[model samples]
Target: MNIQPLFDYIRNHVTLTSEEETFLASKVSYRKYLKGQFVVQQGDVCKYESFVISGCTKTYYVDTEGQEHIVMFSVEEWWTADLGSFITQTPADYNIQCIENTELIMISSDDIEELYIKIPKLERFFRRVIERALAASQKRIIRSFSMSAKDRFLYFREKYPQIEQRIPQYMIASYLGITKEFLSKIKSQIILEQ
Candidate 1:
């Protein structure tokens, strides 16, 4: 598969010389996961940072009550990993699983560190990536505290219109911290309003 998309994503944040691009290409590898496969499981060390090339994945945590709370969803052009575990080389607290058959380009933590040393611009690119991710996460936290369930659903729908069609309603509900029944009600109200 062509890796132009990955290159384009990086180039949007940082310019890469031909040699640098070639070196990056060599360090990354691709993998295909079937739906329902776990890319990273809770209690396993997260070894790779992955970029979605096709399909979707969900990063979630399981509570003591055996409920799954989705922390994030990664679709095409998005990145997914348990950053804390990847950085610290510790067991992951969350699980990353394929929601659909997925193609991903992954760089191991060692390779990423090496890339940072060899190509400083990559370090800058990743720093910005992490910053944006953290900012989005902060926004989510604030929204959860300040917004109503319907408002959260609306905001999520506006931000990720494509994702609703790709994932199950229950998963979306989980991500929004709402019950499936409540999400259904929200959808019905939206349809009636429309």
Candidate 2:
């Protein structure tokens, strides 16, 4: 795979020496997941931080009733992992699964730590990335609690138009904390009024 795009993405945020970029790239592994495959299951130790090169994934938790509640979705140029498990080296409380067949570049926690020792700037880069992720998650939580179903759907469409096209309706409904039927009604209402 051409790694230039990935390198450029990193370079834009962090100034990595040529040798550091080459070393970091060498440590990464390319992985592919089929639709419905679990990248990390509940109770499993999450070993890798993955960057999506293509396709989409959802991170969710199954409740006692076996209901899936989606926490977040990741599409191209996004990262997906159970950060609680990956950082703490504990078992994950959530499942991360591919919604579409996906290609990813992954680096193990161990390898990333090694990179940090060799190139300390990566630590700063990743810390900023984590901060952004936390902020985004906070915003999502506030929106889910504060917005109506129709408003949530509209917000999702405005923010992540690529996801609206690629993900199935039911999964999107779950992510929006609404029923599939309600989502259909929302869509129809918007179309008719437009």
Candidate 3:
């Protein structure tokens, strides 16, 4: 695997020397998943954080009623992991399934610790990534509470236009917390207004 995308993303957050970059690459494992394969299943311990080199995956939870609620989607250049499980080494509540044949550069929790000690700059990169993720999560929570479903859908479309085309409509509806029929109505209304 080229893994250049991971290096490019890291560079955007923190400057790394060539040696540091090479070392980081050595520590990560490259893996590929076919469509519909699970990266992390609920009740399993999430051992590594995966950075998407190509393709898309959805992080979801299957509720007691057996309905799958999508928490988020990870596309090219994004990272996916069960954060709580990966951090604490506990069973994950979320399942990460590939929507397309995906290539990932994954680093285990133990490898992350070693990287932090050897190359402190990597710690800064990871910290910044987590901080931004936390902020975005908080904002999404607020949006869920404040925005109308249609508005929320519109915002999602604007934010993830690329994602909208890659996944099925039903999955998109699940992510938006709306029914597929409702999403159709929303789309129809938007089209009529245009």
Number of the top TM-score candidate: 3
Clashing pairs in 3: none
Whole-model Cα lDDT of every candidate shown, in order: 0.96, 0.90, 0.95
Best of the candidates, lDDT:
1
* Tens digit of per-residue lDDT, candidate 2, span 7-52: 7778879988888988988889888899999999999999999888
lDDT, residue 146, model 2: 92
**lDDT over C-alpha atoms for residue 124 of model 2:** 92
Give candidate 2 misplaced runs (Cα > 4 Å): none
What's model 1's TM-score? 0.98
lDDT (10s digit) by residue, model 1, range 20-61:
999999999999999999999999999999999999999999
Model 2 scores worst on lDDT over the 10 consecutive residues at 1-10
- What CA RMSD would you report for each candidate? 0.9, 1.2, 0.7
| TM-scores for every predicted model | 0.98, 0.96, 0.98
Q: Residue 191 in candidate 2 has what lDDT?
A: 100
